[model samples]
Target: MKKIIMAILLLPIFLNFSGCTKKTNEIPKTSTKIEKSAIEDKKSKVNIILFYPSKEGSSLSASSRLVSFNNSLERTILEEFLKGTDTKDTLYIIPKGTKLLSVSRKEDTIILDLSKEFNDISTENEAVLNNTIYSIVNSLTEIPGIKNVIIRVEGKVPKINNISFENPFKRNRSIFNRDKTSKPNDILKKQMEFESQGRWLDAYLLYSDDENNTYRKYFDDYVKENEEAFAQGFISKNFTVGSYTVDNTGTHALVKVKFNDTNRELNIGMIKIEESWMVDWIPPQ
Candidate 1:
């Protein structure tokens, strides 16, 4: 009888140990599943660049965000663009109620279908129309393996004035205002060379005569003042152009130059005059 009672007591202890082992193993399995799920969620996200119209409607500005990677990435990008940027200086270029209907991809191009509201932008000015079209094109083309974009409105190609959506549109970098046509670095270099050589007349002629220019007076007075300043060592002869950036309008630029001898840096203002870049103002040291 005593042996039977000892056997029953050992069986209860064994059962309790077995239950504890099972619970310990279950905890790691559950934790492992949770970690794997978090990793997959993290891997699904990617960063994408988006373009929008500046507040002035004169140029395109770029913004970036993270999105889920999937077959519908193109549609997702378009949807994010329609939602617009949160930046106060940029505006959504698409019509308010426009919707992305579908997204398909060919060899190197992404084809987009949009709602009828996209076609309702006929009353917008040319700049607005251009911004709307290129904002979509540029944003999509930024994706890898995408070279062009074709936009269709309600299953039909759209044509507003001379602009047409029947053909694939490539990214237009000129709309970013950083293209070769708007760069003012070369003009600033030439003006610096002229000033260094004491050719005041040539340098003065590089100034814009636009009515908005408040820096220049008469041609004779400009030349005389520059000559006197050079004789008095007011202008440095040894300088190097560093870097420059053009304004959003593409009509104005600020160029940074370093005086090699004196180790001083100054910003020179430039303006576009007719077809040429001209020096509008120089900061007084």
Candidate 2:
């Protein structure tokens, strides 16, 4: 009876031991599954990152990010005006979408690596290149360290950002002011002033005077009364030569005239000067 009881207890103990061993083996398999899930989650996180990728991406591009600095004086005109986004350590530069690349900086000048896209530049496309370069230079200057930037394509230096292969458009003109830009003719004005002052030349030179011109008749009478004294002074004084400029076209110049010390302003019609700009008073019909 004692031997039978002892065998039954030992049998129960052995069965429990086998069960525990099976569970232990399963734990390792479960742990492996958990490890695989964690690895997959990490990969997904990497794909979600939103920065401009590395140089080995679909097309290599190196663009600057506009950043802000504490030194306010270094901020360029463009930087000051276009200040909406965060630029705290970001340097703004023109964006690029090309596969080719190159960068060379010497002193204050920086040359960019260019490709075929820069071949034939258009007016609209110029903005991109200009603004891009401008942005880079502007940003760089803000560091209080660098100067301006010069861009070159295919190892050749170019004046403009892009040039057209065909005959290009004419250069646009600069704006001019009407009031301050032009100077008044002092000599012609003096002649007109003398006439208004009642001094006139000889009637012989005046040929015929019409009844219509009140000022003309007055001057003729003044000439007749003053005689040689008026003739000498008036002829010499009335020798007013108004000037007109036709510029490069050589079309005509509008000459403004004033006689003697008179404040009256007179405008002579433009004259046609062949192959050059000429201005003269339009002779009375």
Candidate 3:
């Protein structure tokens, strides 16, 4: 009878210990839900520019693309840009075989290391060439805080057929749609046409005083020295006007031109002296 009484007293104490152990081992359901909610909130949506050929096939036009934010935002945009678009009407700017090897960022600038297939772009189509470059530039610059882009191929700055890709490019919104009444555009078009038709003197007449004197002396020396390449360097098979930016004061401007024989843009600087807009002495500024 005494042993039975001791066993009954120990049973309540054993039940209390088992209940405490179960409570301590359980996880809070609220904490797990909070962690999962934080992970879902990290993802966001951003708008990026995608360039495609216009309806007439003459130039490239910008279109809006919605993308999910990722750690490598610029790379994600480029990969999507390379993939073209879902709609059948849009087109890819970079060549089909081209590959983006790597991308790195430093403050306001993004550096792109691309493969050799990028070098083989057909310059005969000037619009395609300019679009290929700006499609990358304008698209990447859309990301907040990124202002410029530098491109390299095969670990070296590209220099091909009188074109140099060594300069860093700024975002050009002017290329989206050209302004027909732009005086800078008219002057550049006339000058380029004159040169393409072998009218060197007519083309030189459109230059500012400094450019005229410099080119005159250059050609005179070239003629006397029997150096043909120096003079021939000014000539191009054809050119298409891409973009132009005029200062607020309306006296200075920068015009972008792409040549049929070269893959890079030629930025021509212009100044409005008195009444006429003339190509300045310094071509690229």
Residue 172, candidate 1: C-alpha displacement in angstroms: 0.4
Candidate 2: Cα lDDT at 34 = 73
TM-score of decoy 2 = 0.22
Task: Encode model 2's per-residue lDDT on 18-84: one tens digit a residue.
Answer: 8688676564544687787885664332100001112222211122332232222222223332332
- RMSD (Å) of each candidate, 1 decimal: 25.4, 41.8, 28.3
The C-alpha stretches of model 3 lying farther than 4 A from their native spots are 1-46, 55-58, 86-89, 160-163, 178-285
Over 79-143, each residue of candidate 3 has an lDDT whose tens digit, in order, gives 77877766565456556777889999998799999899877766565665666677788777756
Per-residue accuracy of model 1 over 1-285 as CA lDDT, tens digit each: 111212332457557678688666564544677788887887676555578888777888777666676566677788778887887787765668988888999977898899998776763557866886798888786554577798889899886678877788987766764423535778778776787687654565465545434444543345445655567565665678768888899888888877666576667788776656877754422
Considering every candidate listed, which one attains the maximal lDDT? Answer: 1
Error of 2 at 102 (Å): 2.1
- The local distance difference test score of each candidate is 0.68, 0.34, 0.62
The residue pairs found clashing in candidate 3 are none
lDDT value, candidate 2, whole model: 0.34
- Give the clashing residue pairs of candidate 1, or none: none
Better of 1 and 3 by lDDT: 1
